[model samples]
Target: MREHLEGVRLGGEMEEPRIRRAAPYRRIAELREDEEWVKVMGVVVEKKDSEIVLDDGSGLLTVFSDKEGMFEEIGVGSQIRVFGRPMLSVGKEMKAEIVQKVDGLDFELYWKVMEEVKRLEEEIR
Candidate 1:
């Protein structure tokens, strides 16, 4: 029993949530239901104490932070990347576990490569 408990503790410590790269807000808004551990990047359009709104040109969505001080430096017009599980109420909302400030994201180049990658993957399939 003692050995079993130690193994369980070690397993719990080693199992961490997989944080994935954020998708465009357009994709998020189109989701039919809850998705696990999603991330999104956008400009901060609105902010309160624990919640913030981001618009990535595709759409605007709200991300809520559970950590009190996580949003301290976040403000309007700041670009950020946020990770959470997004769910829809009246609209799409996310309870974010991680929020990161970002700069110099080459969106144009990134999208172009994404398009090419998709095309290749489709052809292979």
Candidate 2:
């Protein structure tokens, strides 16, 4: 009985460490806009070769990077936090600079959104 109890305690201890590691990312959504730099958790909704589109619940913003190598591991459905100036393009499209992806969480949200968009497009056809 003592051995079983110790095993259960060990399992609980392992889970707590993982939860604590993720706690910092949970606070990403609380960032304020007035701050010079803001960290936001967002899903990568679009990836067009060199460009990436991140959707942080509010809206989608485009990120353009000259270093395409940085984007090799990023997929359409990845979650990322961008650190840079937000600007409006000539076409009034909003975008961010110096974007970085969040690790561990699979880009599942991006895949889900992409599937929905594809379904809608098919219906329109």
Candidate 3:
């Protein structure tokens, strides 16, 4: 028998699903306006009090967060990955939800792998 979540209330309603969709990994230049979630890997070229400028070779993008401790371990020249929601109202930027350091990623190899993954996904569709 499976457990039921009928009594569960999300924001006083029981309609919310328990799963979150995965954010797609994308290069800075390929991000689309319609995408709700996105993941990007880049070098932290510049970091401020609330934002960091990331360069993924394809382009430069600003990733910001108002939440505390989000940029604690991040520093200039640090290679990191950011998962966030894009905010295109002003310029090329995103409201970061998660930021993680990537210690030894080889961008050349990573790019090749992503290209192959995209090709496979296209074939499946």
TM-score of each: 0.69, 0.45, 0.84
Weakest lDDT window of 10 consecutive positions for candidate 3:
1-10
With a 3 Å backbone cut-off (N, CA, C), the pairs that clash in candidate 3 are: none
lDDT of 3 by residue, 4-100 (tens): 7677656755676767689889999988778889999999999898999999999999999989878889999999999998877788899999999
Candidate 2: list runs displaced more than 4 Å. 1-38, 89-97, 103-125
Backbone clashes per model, in order? 1, 2, 0
| lDDT of the structure predicted as candidate 3 | 0.90
lDDT of 2 by residue, 8-124 (tens): 644343444422121112122243333443334577788877777776665556666666565677897787766643344232132344566676655456547655875787899
Clashes of 1: 1
1 or 2: which has the higher TM-score? 1
lDDT (Cα atoms) of all candidates against the true structure: 0.75, 0.55, 0.90
Ranking by TM-score: 3, 1, 2
TM-score of model 1 relative to the true fold?
Answer: 0.69
Show the lowest summed lDDT stretch of 10 residues, model 1.
24-33
**In model 1, what lDDT does residue 95 have?**
85
lDDT by residue for model 1 (1-125), tens: 78767746443457678776655333444544546666677889999999998887667888887788988988898888887777776687888888999867775565577668767878999
